[model samples]
Target: VVPGINEIYDPRTKTWSEGPERYFPTYPALFLTQGGEIFYTGSNAGYGPADEGREPGLWDLESNTFTEVGGLRDADQLETSASLLLPPAQEQRFMVLGGGGVGESEESTERTAIIDLTEENPRYRDGPPLPQGTRYLSSVILPDDTVFTSGGSEDYRGRGDSDILKAQFYDPATNSFRPAADPTVGRNYHSEALLLPDGRVATFGSDPLFGDADNTRMGEFEKRIEVYTPPYLHDGREERRPVLGEGPERAAPGETVTFATGQPGRIAEARLMRPSAVTHTTDVEQRSLQLEVRRGAGGVSFTLPEDPSLVPPGWYMLFVSDEEGTPSEATWIQIGEGLAKD
Candidate 1:
């Protein structure tokens, strides 16, 4: 069986597990919902008609299942994209929007569809179609109920296939489209937007490694990253906030580690998700620090306890809850006594 689109590991046994059987396109952007469900859209149904192969759909994680929502998938829907709504509200259901399928007999679509996941029978509903047609664009949901879509090709066949600078934002409440800040360069097929802790959004991708001139997908790949600061989020005053950056790769036993946070803030607690070694399911081990937010000229720093026995040599994550008691960001730390030691 094909492995699920996005796979998770048990962490205990160090074994990995796939989500569910959703006829996923294997290479499409996936969004994980607050409810732990996975939804992916956009793909060509290799066996179907040109249009039949390209449809946008989703898969549920709890039941280990997949469901085809509603989309015009066909051979033409070559590239698919999906982004889960962040800061999801009770009234607003999970929202996913994308480009692909067919907008015309011989080409891909400029149309966008919204799925109301909160509905009992979640189905696709009409969303404001892109003012300009496009395909293979990246989508991201912001904290303010704003969905941003950027990059992608417009009118693939006739337009000479140049990258588009075009991008837009959608307001779920009004079901309307509004213009958002545009990127300096035109990119499609390889781009992604990530919401930053300061309420700004960062978009990366279009790496040359991921896509090429002949095959757009092969040249846009890159390890480089970029940030996008939204004007609407500026507060004039800069407040010290903590952002959990990427964590350690592996941890052995007895290694002193520094946590990752963009700006320093109070680090109150810590947790270790132990690898099962057998099943790989993560088992939670809570270590109480109850530390207070100490201010410094440079920034805040949290010191790990001296006992190396507290953590075994393996992969573990350090979750630091801020003074507010809300878990800020997780830092992956490896505890060990050797080369794996940082």
Candidate 2:
């Protein structure tokens, strides 16, 4: 209902400052693009004009410009949808998941779209579709560079018992979906999935309107929690998982930090995934940045990207993935203006 109004908060100053006169829908799915620009995936939740500010695009706050990106299927049904910055954030790729019709309509779509912003002219391209039409789905970026998505409803607020229990992993490398263990409970409306530091994904909260298909029975908030363990942790691989030891507690951008790993030779890649801050399936901060790894006999070294814009000052989880794409349990690394512990 509000437009041309925005605010920015400074944690250090503990004060709110006036931001650029740009407006966004509630919980807009925006990723911080390079040079202080923001990319909106057009995935959103809650209410507004339903027409205004609904297109996917690169939003430049400095000059007050919006360059729209095309090629999204079911663009009108983006409400309750999910958007994610694809793994290895340097690729600058993003995806929008399934969503429902505008303003309480029962319609939904099983479509997905991906956009690579690195290209000269970035546009959304159709990726693999979901198994069924869903809304309010929750997604978590796994440590192994795959996205674990699960749980949504076919209708708004899971009306008509439309909650979907399907779960799948989307691999960016292959652009395909792999079957994952189905969640026991149906999740719709208020739900979220998060990646744990131990490499497991934890799911929480789902509020359905009704318990049954007829919508006769009143619904209750699901209090139980579920955790998903990816395949990398199993199959006799526990002993072989790369371990990060003796790393700095804090380091500045453009600094090289070394960690002791037993099997440095098998380390194919390392990444720093910003600790996620999400609400209602909208996570603008959830992104992964690949670190250039140099192997040493008993450890490995990761040089943080020189650009502070690429890596905002915050806490991140550093995971080293082996040749088999198996990631180690995360080690905490803080990026800021600080010296490392000798």
Candidate 3:
């Protein structure tokens, strides 16, 4: 709870200040504003109306304080499934798009909402609905402030489907959203999207869509990592090719690769893709690694442990992320006969 000096609180002094509240308990995501405040959305883990069970809404962070933001009235609403913090223009703003919540009844929703931070308390105004229906998807923020969201699930006309591998982008400048290149590999649950240093979006994770009768999903999880680069991009005068670096061909068995945007203030925890074989070595193994790469560092590297069991001969994908665990570029590499030095 304490980042630096550990001291007990004294109600008598009316100070010692309160502790920083941990908002993310179950896949909760947040973003940092240009004004140095944290913006987040929380979901109910079947706790109560206060937690919403499935209800999703916004939360604010300023001066180490936590305040709730826009939320759905229904306890089962999942409207704010995914979001990204847009760099301040006229005022601070957030692009919240494509999340599934309770529609008419207990059914899922496909609405999009944008939160304008310039306001006193911030306002959530509904945006143009998604081109198609979607739910349980993820998004990323580009240097130009474009938000790209990927595949999700839900039956359209009544046919139950999950692998909705479509993609879309939202631009705040115009207060509108447009479509981006779609991914070849589609996923549902447990999947994530990351923004790469080279201006492309990398996505990894698994599909929650179960197959007919008995096949099940992709062996409990996905080790496949794919990167998506914009077909066209420009800096000022000349065209700029996407320049994300390639990871190790072999990852020294258990080593990991990290990604970063080279921006300082925009730093947070990094996420990685694990091979399905990676089991719980201990209680801690159940969770993802929380490594914060130095801002403006321009790049992040994950040195493989010299241990043999940690990394064996196998191919794996590595992904890095910010504090909210929104993934960046996902580089694919193989781990073969090689030492840490090699």
User: By TM-score, who's the top model here?
Assistant: 2
Instruction: For each candidate in turn, give its C-alpha RMSD to the true structure in angstroms.
Output: 10.6, 1.6, 13.3
Candidate 2 per-residue C-alpha lDDT over 1-342 given as tens digits, one digit per residue, 9 for 90 to 100: 356587778978999988777666777887888677889999888577777878989988778799999989899999899999998888889999999887788999999889999899999999999999989888888877899999988998898988898899999999999889999988898888889998888888888888889999998998989998888888877667877788788889899998987777988988899987877777889988988999988989988987777888889999988888778888998887664545
Q: After best superposition, candidate 1 residue 299: deviation in angstroms?
A: 20
Candidate 3 per-residue lDDT, tens place, 1-342, comes to 322222336545867754455434233444434344545533211112333323233333334445566533222344325554443222445554544443322244566666776677765677767766565566655444455667665531112444566787776668777787777775655666665544476788754434432434323455688887653342331132222354345545345544444343444434333333211100111111223344336655555534333333445445443433234444555555553322
For candidate 1, the TM-score is 0.53
**TM accuracy, model 2:** 0.95
Clashes of 2: 0
Candidate numbers sorted by lDDT from highest down: 2, 3, 1
lDDT of 1 at 210: 31
Report every candidate's CA lDDT.
0.47, 0.86, 0.47
lDDT of 3 at 174: 82
Q: Which stretches of candidate 1 lie over 4 Å from their true place?
A: 1-8, 17-23, 28-67, 70-78, 86-92, 101-106, 155-161, 207-226, 234-342
Whole-model lDDT, model 1: 0.47
Estimate the lDDT of model 3: 0.47
TM-score of every prediction relative to native: 0.53, 0.95, 0.53
